[model samples]
Target: MRNSRNSKSNKSKSTVMFILVLLIVGALAYTGAFGINNIFGYRVKSFEQAINKGLDLQGGISVLEELQAENIDNETIERTKELLSMRINPEGVKEISITREGSNRIRIEIPGEFDAKKVLETIGKTGKLEFKGPDGKVILTGKDIKNAKAYLDEMSKPTISLDLNQEGTGKFAEGTQKFLGKEIGIYMDGDLLTNPTVQSVITNGKATITGSSSLEEANRKANIIKSGALPVTLEAVEFKTVGATLGANALPLSMKAGAMGIGLVLLFMLIYYRGPGIMASIALVFYVVIVLLAFSVTGVTLTLSGIAGFLLTVGMAVDANVLIFERIKEEMKIGKTIKNATETGFNRALSSILDSNITTIIAGIVLYSLGSGSVKGFALTLMIGIVLSIFTALTVTKFLLKLGTEMGLLSDASHFGVKRG
Candidate 1:
C-alpha cells in the first residue's frame, strides 16, 4: 500500500513538472527569442530587433575609396584607414566596417544607413593638420609630426604624446620659445581643435598634448592629428547602397525554413526515441532560447550566412542527443537498469560529443580570424551555436533526463528504444 502510494505521489509530481516545463518553454519560444506584440499594450521585441544586422541583412551603403597620392606608403594608408574608421564609427554602435583592399583602396560597409552621399561628405575631406601661433602664422603641418599616440602619464592623466621629425624638431623648438607664454592653436581642417598655452620650450622633438576628458577622447584626438597628415586625397572610386527590400524578403524565408527544419527534427526524435525523445525536444527548445539570448546580449551582428550557421548547429544539437540515446540503449541491452544506463551512457558519449564539437569550433575560429564580411558572420554564429549546443546537450539535457528518471517517467528499456531480453 505504501509502495503504491509512493508511485501515485511520483506520477502527480511528474505531471506538475511536465506542465511547468512546457509553460516555460512555450513562453520563451513565443515571447523571448521569437518575441510577441501588443498583448497588454507592450511590445516584446525580437532578438533581431535588439541585435545589429549586417549590411547584407539590413541593407546599407558600400564605398570603395582609393588614396590619390604619389608614392603611397603603408604608414599613410594605415593611418588614413584608422582616421576614417574613427570618424565614421565614432560611437562604435553601428556595424560600420573599414577594411583595406589591395594597397591603396579601402572598402567601407555601413549597415542600416542608406545615404551614401552623407557618408561620403563625412569621409571625403582631407582634413589638413595645422599648428598656428598667436600671431596666426603657420608653425607646423601634419607631415612635421613623426608619431602620435595616447598614453596615461605618471599622474594617470590621459595625454597625447607627439613625436616630431628632425626638421619639425628644430621648427617646434623655435616656435615654443617664441610662444612660450602665449596660446598656440592646433587646427584640423581649419577647425580649431585646441589652443594650449605653451608651458615650456624644449628642443627634444617630443611634446605632450594634454586636457582630454577621457582616454578614448585622447585617442580620438591623436587619430585626428595623424589623419590630417593624410597626404592623399580620398577619392570615392565607387559608392552603392544595398537594397533593404531584398534583405527583408530573404530573412523571412530563411526563418521559415529554419523553423520547419527544427519542427521536423522534434517530430523525428519523438517518433523514434519515445521518452528520451520528449526530453531531447524540450532541451532543444531551451538551447534555441539560450543561443538567441547570447546573440542579443553579445551584440553579434547577424547576416544571412549567420542564420545558416545557427541552423547547422541545431543539427549538431540533435546529433548529441542521438549519441547519448544510442549509448543508453547499448548499456540497457546488457541488462543495466535505466538509471545506471543513463549515467554510463552520458559518461561514455561525452568524449565523442566533445571531440566533434571541439573540432567544429576550431574550424569556426579559423574562419572568423581569416574570413571577412559574410564569412565572418557565419563563423561567429557557428562557434556560438556549437558552444551552446555542448552546454544544452551535457548540462540541460542531462538535467532533464535525470529529472524524468526521478519522476519514474524514464524507467524502462523500451522507453529508451531498447527491447528487453
Candidate 2:
C-alpha cells in the first residue's frame, strides 16, 4: 500500500513536468516562427521572413525561349545561354537562373522581377563585338576571329588563347605592328572586356592575353569573344508573369493544409499512445525547429515543391514514432518493465527506420543530380528531411522517452499503447 502511494505521487509529478514541457516548447516554437514586438530597444524579425523564397513562393517572370535555327545543337544552345548570362549578369549575381529545358528551349527565371517589358528589352539586346585601337578606330571585329579559349599559363595563372582566321591574322599582324606598346581595348556590346597593351606583332594568328585574376574571369571573357553572335535567334515562346499577390495567396493555402494534417497527426498520437505520444510530440517540435534552422543556415530557396518535401518528411517522422510505440507495446505485453520495454522498442525499430530512410536518401541524391530547377529544390529538401528525420527519431525521441521513464510517467502499460489484463 505504501509503494502504491509513492507510485501515484511520482506519476503526478511527471504529469506536471510534461505539462511544463508542452507550454515551454509551444511558446518557443511560436516565437521562432512569427516573432514578437520590441521588448526593450531592439526589434526582432522572424526567421521565416529571412529565408529565401523561390519564384513560385515569391514573385517572378519566367521566359521560355526557343532557338529559331534549322540546325541548332546542344553546343549552340549552351553558347546561347552564355550570351544571355553575359547580358543579364553584367554587374554581378542576381536572383536569376538560366537552364535548358529540352533540345530547343532555354528557360530563364528571375525572382522578384515583375517588369515584363523591361526584362524583354534586356533579353532582346544582342550586341556586336569590336576590338578598338588606341585612337578608338576598329582594329578587329568578331567576324575575323576563328575561336577563343581560356587556359592556364606555365606559372598556373589564368590566360586567354586567341586563334585567328587567315583574314583576321593578316589584319591583326598589321594592327599589332602599328599599335605596338599601345593599349587596345576588346569590347563586347560597348562594354570593355579587357584592355591590354600590345606586346609584339603576331604573324602566326595566335595571341595570349594575361592579367586575368582567375580562371572563371578568363572563361567569361573567352566565352564572350568566342560567341559574340549567337548561332540562332532566341524567340520568346512563352512568358509566365507571376505576381507577389498570387504567391501570397498560395502560401496561406499551403500553410492551412499542412497545419490541418499536422494537427490530425498530433491528435491521433495523443489519443492512441497516452504518455509516449506526448513525448514524441515534443521531440517533433524540436525536429521542426532544427529543420527550419538548417534551411535558414544553408540559405535554401523554399518553394511549394520544397514544402511538399518537408511535409512528407513530417509524416515520415510520425511513422517512426508509431513504429517504436508499437514495439514498446509488444515488449510490455511480454512482461518487461516500462524502461526496459522502451529501450528494446527503440532498438528494434531502429533498423527498419534506417533502411527506409537510407533508400529515400539515395533517391533524393539521384533526383538532385539529374533534375533541374524546382525538381532540384524538391530533392534538396527531401534529402535534408530524410537525414533530419533519422536524427530526431534516434536521438531526440529516445532522449525524451528516457526522460519520461526516469520521471516515472511511463510506468503504466497503457501509456505506451499496451492494454493491461
Candidate 3:
C-alpha cells in the first residue's frame, strides 16, 4: 500500500512537469521578447518577427566605395572596414556586410535598408569632425575623441556628451582660455554642427553638445562621432539597390526542403525505434523549439547558409538518439530490465555524444571568430543547434524514456527493440 501510494505520487509529479514543459515550449514558440499585432486585433510577439533574415533572404542596398587618399595601405582599409561596420550595424541593424574589395575599396551590403540615399550620405561622408575657435583655428579632431554618447539633459532635452583624450583636453583647454566668452564651432566635413559660447575655460575632458532637434538626431551624431573618422575620405564609386523577389522565392523553396527533411527524420525515428523512437521524436520537437527561440533571442540573422547548417545539425540530433537506442537494445538483449537498460544505455552513449558535439562546437566557434558574412551565420546556427541537440538527447529523451518505464508502457524488452533471451 505504501509503495502504491508513492508510485501514484511520482506519476502525478511527472505529469505536472511534462505539462509545464509543454506550456513553456508553446509560449516560446508563439511569443518572444516583444509583442506583435495579428489581424484579429490580438498583440503577441512571435519568433518569426524576432528572427531577422539575411541579404539572401531580403535584398537591399549595396555600395562600393574607394578611399580618396593617395598611398592607402591594407591596415587603413581594415580599420575603415571595422569602423564602417560599427557605424552602420551598431547594435540594431542585422546582417549588414562590410568587406574590403581591393587595395583601396570597400564593399558594403545592407539588407532591408530602405533609404539608400540616407545610407550613402551617412557612410560615404568624410566625417572629419573638428572643433574650431572663433578665429577658425582647429582645436581638436575626431581622433582625439575618447568617447561620445547621447543622453537627456536636466530639462529633458536631447544632448550629446563628448569625452576627449588627454591631448584633446589640453588643446581644448588652451583654445577655451584664448577665446573666453566666444563661440567654438563644431564641424563635420566642413559643415557646422553647433557653435557654443566658451563661457569659461574647461579643464575637464568632458563637454556636451546641446540644441539637437531630437533624440534621434543626437544619437545619430553621437554614433558617427563614436565610430571614429576614416583615415582617408571615401568616394562612392558604385551604388545599387538589390531587389528581393529572387530571395523571396528562394526562401520558400529552402523552407520546403528543410521541412521535408525534418519530416522524414521524424518518420524514421518513429518507425525504427518504435516506442523509444516516438519519445525521441517528441524530444526533437522540444529541441527544435528551443533552438529557434535561442536564435530569435540571440538576434542571429538566418541566411541560406545558416539554414543549411541547421538542417545538418538536425541529422546529427537523430544520430545521437539512434546511438542511445541501439545501446539500450544491446543492454536489454543482455537480460537487463527496461529501466536498467535505459540508464546503462545513456551512460554508455554519453561519452561519444559529448565528444562529437563538443568537437563540432569548437569548430563552429573558431569559424565564427575567424570568418565573416555567411560563414559567421552558418557557424552561429551550427553552434546553437549542436547545443540544443545535446540538451534534448541527454535531458528530454532520458526523462521521457524513464517516464515511459514508470508508467509500465515500456516494461517488456521488445518495446525497446530487444528480443527476449
TM-score of 2: 0.74
Q: Candidate 1: where is the Cα deviation over 4 Å?
A: 1-31, 34-45, 66-80, 101-105, 144-173, 200-222, 231-237
Models 1 onward score TM values of 0.82, 0.74, 0.83
Off by over 4 Å in 2: 1-31, 35-45, 70-76, 90-93, 127-129, 138-181, 193-231, 362-373
Rank by TM-score, descending? 3, 1, 2
Per residue, candidate 2 scores C-alpha lDDT tens digits across 197-314 of 8999989999999899998899778877876666678899999988898789888898789889988888888898889888888888878877877887788888899999989999
lDDT of 2: 0.84
lDDT of 1 by residue, 1-421 (tens): 9999997897778778877988988898777756787868988788768777888877999999988877888787877877788678754457787777777888899988987778987787667789999999999998898888898999999999889999999999999999998999999889998887899996999999889988888887887776664556888889889999878988878879998999999999999999999999999999999899899888888889999999999999999999999999999999998889999999999999999999999999999877777888899999999999999999988988877887877877788778886
Cα shift from native, residue 117, model 2 (Å): 2.3
lDDT of 3 at 154: 90
- Worst 10-residue stretch by lDDT in candidate 1? 223-232
Clashes of 1: 0
For residues 1-421, could you state the per-residue lDDT of candidate 3 as single tens digits? 9999999887777767766766776565455534467848876656556688888788888888988998887878887887788667755446787876657888888988868878987796666888898888899898999888899999999999889999999998898899998899888778786787877787898888887888877877777677768777888999888789867897889879987998899998887788898788878877877787788778888889999999989998998999999999988888887888889999999999999999999999999887767887899999999999998999999998887777666768777767784
